[model samples]
Target: MSVVILTIKISHFINHVNKMLGKVNEEDLKSVIDNTKRLTGNLARISDNLDEKEIANLIKSAVAKS
Candidate 1:
């Protein structure tokens, strides 16, 4: 995702949390939970171009050489 879009999501999350401050209601709680889930899901979807085993092999080879 673009940095701009991430920034906007963070801004919206901050605003949503801020607005819920000093209030305790069922709807507010649910909204917070939903927003948290969405943000986490988006974060989990960020592109990962690394291979875990490849990294471990590279480290092992370097350690053996050194």
Candidate 2:
């Protein structure tokens, strides 16, 4: 997904967490949000580098063998 969508989802998650657990530490929450953004960005980059056609072919080969 796009970064915009990821940000909106993250914001909603933080809001939900805040509501469920009152008085969360701002520093801790900030750390979590930052880490999440970093991790998702890395994952998106990795996924972008992958060859979708190659992966699909591999999957099809495996299924055909089975």
Q: Quick one: best TM-score, which candidate? A: 2
Best by lDDT: 2
The total number of steric clashes, by the backbone 3 Å criterion, in model 1 comes to: 0
Candidate 2 Cα outliers beyond 4 Å, as residue runs: 1-19, 51-66
Q: What tens-digit string does per-residue lDDT give for candidate 1 at 1-66?
A: 999999999999999988867476878888989988986665455425446776567558867998
User: Per-residue lDDT for 26 in model 2?
Assistant: 78
lDDT by residue (1-66, candidate 2, tens digit) is 999999999999999988966777778888999988996786567567678776567558867998
Inter-residue clash pairs, candidate 1: none
By summed lDDT, the worst window of 10 consecutive residues in model 2 runs over 54-63
lDDT of 1: 0.75
Error of 1 at 18 (Å): 19
Clash total of candidate 2: 0
